[model samples]
Target: MKKIKNNFICKIIEKDILKNKHIKIRTRFPPEPNGHLHIGHAKSIFINFNIAKIYNGKCNLRFDDTNPYKENIKYINIIKKDIIWLGFKWNKKIKYSSNYFNTFYKYAMLLIKKGLAYVDSLNKFEIKKYRGNLKKKGTNSPFRNRSILENINLFKKMKIGKFQEGDVCLRAKINMSSKIILMRDPVLYRIIKKKSHHQTKKKWCIYPTYDFSHCISDYIEKITHSICTIEFQENKKLYNWILKNINIKKKPKQYEFSRLNIENSLLSKRKIKILIKKKIIKNWSDPRLLTISGLRKRGYTPSSIRKFCYNIGITKKENLIQMSYLEHFIRNDLDKKVNRAMAILNPIKIIIYNLPKNYKKIISIPNHPKIKKFGKQNIILRREIYIEKNDFEEKNKKNKKKLFINGKVKLRYSYIIKAKKIKKDRLNKIKTIYCKYYNKKQSKKIKNNIIIHWISKKESIKANFEMYENLFTTKHPEKKKNMLQYINKNSIIIKHGLVQKDIFSKILKKYIQFERIGYFFLKKNKIKNITFTCITKLKK
Candidate 1:
């Protein structure tokens, strides 16, 4: 639980502070509220919030909600919930880029008056063509040379919805001949005839682009360091250019770091949305997904995720972490905490023929090993019981040590039993295993070869158990031409199972380890006098 301080980014921030450069570091996590935050966002949040906390500075949760067509209030609320779930709190009230629309508009006008930016009449396709390639210089738009007065008037008209979508755009008047293509007059604003904004609503039709609004918003809020993904490294030049051109009192520095990537999942919101739209996935919060809500549904704890992030740390080099590493973290976190119970999956009836038919006894089982404070639960022992079919074998020739007919093994924490006979169905499939239990004191005198888990059939609860595996068959499912082609067909296996009667008495939502099996959570659906469902841990 000690604070992590070994990351290179933290060292850089410390170096800056010691040099008396950017005395009060202010950071911001600016997420576009178009979709649910993913694991990649978790890294950004951790770095930003922790840096601020380290320096005793401030971090702001700013929503870059300029795109009215894709942004929504639902996404905003979900983002807030996700940040809080990851254990981060902003220094002050939540802020949105849309709140500075009027300010951004005035700045755009300032650029026009100074002949630094102009309204371009080129359509979207023509603008891309004019922008040229990386090795070439772009041609100036025909409207780029328009008088400052005309360009300002056209920008005003676009704001009032006089132009159709993509008809006119505001572009920064940077050099087209510059080596960096992003420095070549990037589009600052575009016209969109969307319905309305979630916060602003119908006030304007023209919206500022991310490249234009991002840096200026940081300066407006007096941010000291703007941390973003490495993909925006090229955009950093334009970010600096806009701040230098504008008359901002304090300029913020932009830093880039590599975004996090998981081996077997798609992190793009667009791809996930397509899957959900095509019904390939159940929903956004499907347990197979890597979203926060999805992880929550899959029985992952917030603390475990935070620990996973901490272990991975922050870095500039991109990495593809194996999914097993995450599972290892989860197992390590839950092993000491979760209480233990016994549940038998794929059960076959075991008949104790030597025991009295009417005999019954209660045996005590500890809830947790090496933890005396957790107490114990009472398990009933009867004539009929259920054990996993995989725990037994039909023949002993191939495997002489196997648990077969006439073989001896200890029933976990109970007496030793010798298999008397195996009864097969008409198709020669083993249906019943008949055994004879040795007397209690006599069984304890001798050690059994194998220890197996079993539940009393008479007092057992019949339930349906679900075992989940990785949703993808390959390491990079999204990189393939068809994700479904790599889908793990055996991701989920359902079995008619049985568990000790003590487990059936509790209806809590918390997860519990099933002794030799994996962890399980109670399913929402309950059958009337017939069955119950529990979701098992994800297979490694």
Candidate 2:
């Protein structure tokens, strides 16, 4: 494991250990299983799990599945798979907020008995109106002063499905005129009718709100530190209030860090759902998005992501991170690990007129330019091969870098070739280029010549390459009223390309770079055609 850099969270943990405040440091990564995990969640995962690992402590993986309205078992499973794919494991068996449904109900009863909470008869809209905003003080709900017995009875009725979904709820009896709006008698429990939970199905109708469940769950799990994002900083007061009013012997400390916000990206699940609804994106795993599954499918390695998170560090101030910052890490990672190969995306046929018909030579090239241990790959150099269409020009075109009539260019890892003449089809397009090959000794005579990647016609496989760009055109798409309008028209460009036939023999799930092209991952390997997703260009 790399040495974790000193951050504010680490400093706190160090102080706690030095003061003998905690013998065994414990943390938990609590993700709500309502949607797919995005890159932002990955930062939290790195902090909690790595903190525990660094301190020789424990970290629990718990699902905060309090909201069953949009939660699903499939989401829970996918979240687990994503975490595992990112190279992490929970300390033990996974946990869920639903696991403590009965205990939460009992705690709510305790609050009522102590006259700290009461059943509110106001509907949601009315409750919001009564809660007021930051500028104005809220008015107490008429039901806020209900007797303890009456409140408990109403709460029981809510549990037994006696009330409609939004008819009534249980609210903590906090000061209505408090400066913090969230402290103004926040709802502790609400009724969701006929909706079954992923873990506890048809067992209860009343569900605990996140503000009520989170701190208590931390207490029950004996978590020493409850880490969350900066948005939850205000809610930390309610988190502590629940723990304090409940008279817990040992309370966990809550710390906040800035959430990861990428430029030209949407991290919110609600907004992602909107994109899916409008068909702007296919699903949570769309390569165009920054969802963890999406990144994994797009050929980003776990180590690269971890390194990015570590370098970014934890901070209280929120900021937008550039997309290039992330691309740099992935590029640095794949540049050293992935094997090198030759491919042509816009191919044009080239025939060596001087070579005999059906001539072939086995050529060996290093899998990695610098790493000898990565070994070499053998490709057949034949008389008939395909180079990129853009590599050749009909005339000089004022650029001596590209192939022109009678111009000489060196093929990557092969002998130099001189374009003698070209064959044009009836449409007046360059159909074929006739070239003459020169051996290694004579090839050394050519100076300042451009080298390009190519593949033999008979020894290549057909492939579909999906090249990706930022989904949004603007840097801050989320700030706009209509993010769809900022969608880049050419975000995903599919190109029919060719790769070496034996590339399938290389390791699957490992990224491969086409010389002078980009890093790519084989998404689908079929008998006739393969699908490769371009991770990033060779340079940022």
Most accurate candidate by lDDT: 2
Segments of candidate 1 deviating more than 4 angstroms = 1-6, 135-137, 177-179, 397-402, 444-449, 504-509, 525-540
**Per-residue alpha-carbon lDDT of candidate 1 for residues 214-285, written as tens digits (9 for 90 to 100):** 998999888888989898999999998888888876788888888777887878898898889977678878
- State each model's CA lDDT, in order: 0.82, 0.90
C-alpha TM-scores of all predictions? 0.92, 0.94
- In model 1, the Cα lDDT at residue 231 comes to 89
Write candidate 2's Cα lDDT for 374-444 as tens digits.
Answer: 88889888999999998899788774578889888888889899999999999999999999999878887
Instruction: Supply the global lDDT for candidate 2.
Output: 0.90
Error of 2 at 271 (Å): 1.0
Quote the positional error of residue 210 for candidate 1 in Å.
1.2
